[model samples]
Target: MRRLGSALLAVGMLVGCGPGTQAETPPESAPSAEQQQQAPILTTTNVDVAIECSGILEFANTASYTLLDRYLPSNVVTNIVNRRATAPFTSLADLSSVPLVGPTRLKQLEGGARTMDFIDADCVGILDGIAISRDDQTAIVNLVNTIDDSELHDVLPDAWNGAVNLLNTRPFTTAQQIADTAGIGDVSFRNIRNSATLSRPLEALFTAINAIPSNGSYGATTLRHFDWWNIASANHYYRDQKECFGLEPTSVPYGASIRPNLANAAEVRAEVQRAFDYVGGNTKVSAAVRDAGFANLDALIQGRSFKGCILTYENDPWSRNTVHIYVDTVNGFSVMTETWWAE
Candidate 1:
């Protein structure tokens, strides 16, 4: 039940819409009406980020051998786990005590730590408010205790009346109380648990938005607008196919036929801000939240992750160097920009 579910795909329209690290100015030609119709629908998946810690030290205390192996070799992972079993780690220095976790690997772990989540109840201080079902019962309890009635109902449409009543009671001491007080059946309770997955907070979304570099290497600039061709081309490619762009074969198997367009950094950032607001339930951007799967901004963001891919133009003009940004959203809201040429 803790595993990620299938990414729900809905065929929806592409609406158009970055910079920095800087790419060459792009030439533009609008897509034909028929081409516009053919543009790709934004793709969506249930956001399910894995648990991670803020730093290597925290990871040492919490990560199982399997998770540790992601950062260390099996031998190193075994040593770390065994060492921790005998004496818990109190700091990063302790990791070096484990065989094979040399200074180089330790530094790599330090860098990788930023990408991980810290869900250990004993370790998580501020992050305790965020919850996923896989975390201890306390996380589930916190979720049921804190979620908005409207959001609860949205996640469990079948239990609307119960959801409102569940919210009114306030501060349920245990996760089980949710079902008991609301009269929501086992099915609804399971729905609540399943929906409890959320890895980050609302603020993290802004952090990611701000993190889109002003200039990326490989002629990658902040994306300004995604033309109809980019939209249609991107739609034809799935995450892996697009990700494979920089590797070779000159063209994507997904059938993307044109080079990407890059433009003004400020304009692209502004558009991304608008997209974030629209997705976050800020009605100023749109009357409705674009995706029904998410009850609110928090719902969309909790388990979400953003991925970027590099497209190189080494062999063909059609294969212009570009960066593609993907978010787990109903509209795909995907956009691209030219990047520096890749070798």
Candidate 2:
């Protein structure tokens, strides 16, 4: 009876352990959509490893300079480091041409060592626009917003007043009326008017006057009427003319104590005719002629120089016909009259 009972129990246990008797299959681990989408494809350590390995592979080419340094032998962990000991790398190209670093190694190095944290730290902001080449040193920094003419007057009111005052005091016979109409101030206008006969250009005289700040050191009087008018006018009018005529206008010699002798009206007229004749014949005088004219005028003045010549000529645009006046000191003439009629 006992043996028969043992046999039945063993059979029962084996029957319970059959294939279908295990717990219902763990519901098939099916990853959720979000988990699959957000999983990190690569780790930071993996990236670092890749870059280091690639750098080692491309050591012969890209890192020739670093390889030649003292740290290379001690730092290199590879057993094949002795192979590079005889690297006859005189130049970067020679190092790159080594057969050990082939295309496959080059590609690996390019991809892995494209960016390294240690190397990148040194390169931060290296490629900014502020770092210009030496040749581009004079490049102008363009202003985003430019000042308007109207705003300029408001910004520099004193300069405007100085300019107006200077203009008002100029010594033309019609200056007072012009000044009055132009709405120049009394005190400022009077000062300029009194000083106008000093024979300097109005602008230069003003510049000299204005150079004395409201509270500043005074200097010796240097600007004169001739300095103001003839010299100054020549400077102003001939600026554009100099470029057109290919002549260089020089600065006025203030230290020279020379006065221009006034040429008679007849001689002045003849000179004017000569200029007109040259212009009329050539249609345009060469730069050489213009330069010669300056020299001739200087010689004619004998230290004293006038601004312009005064003479009447035929009225035609094509024909150079107008009155030229020598207003500056070299010529006795003090007036320049020009008349133009629109056809």
Name the best candidate (by lDDT). Answer: 1
lDDT of 2 by residue, 164-191 (tens): 4334444333332323434344333322
Q: Residue-pair clashes per candidate, as listed?
A: 28, 21
Cα displacement (Å) at residue 62, model 1: 27
Q: Which run of 10 residues does model 1 get worst, by summed lDDT? A: 10-19
lDDT of 2: 0.28
**What lDDT does candidate 1 reach at residue 82?**
62
Worst 10 residues of 2 by lDDT: 1-10
Candidate 1: tens digits of C-alpha lDDT, residues 231-290: 323442223233432212432336433334322334334444454543332432232323
lDDT of 1 at 153: 52
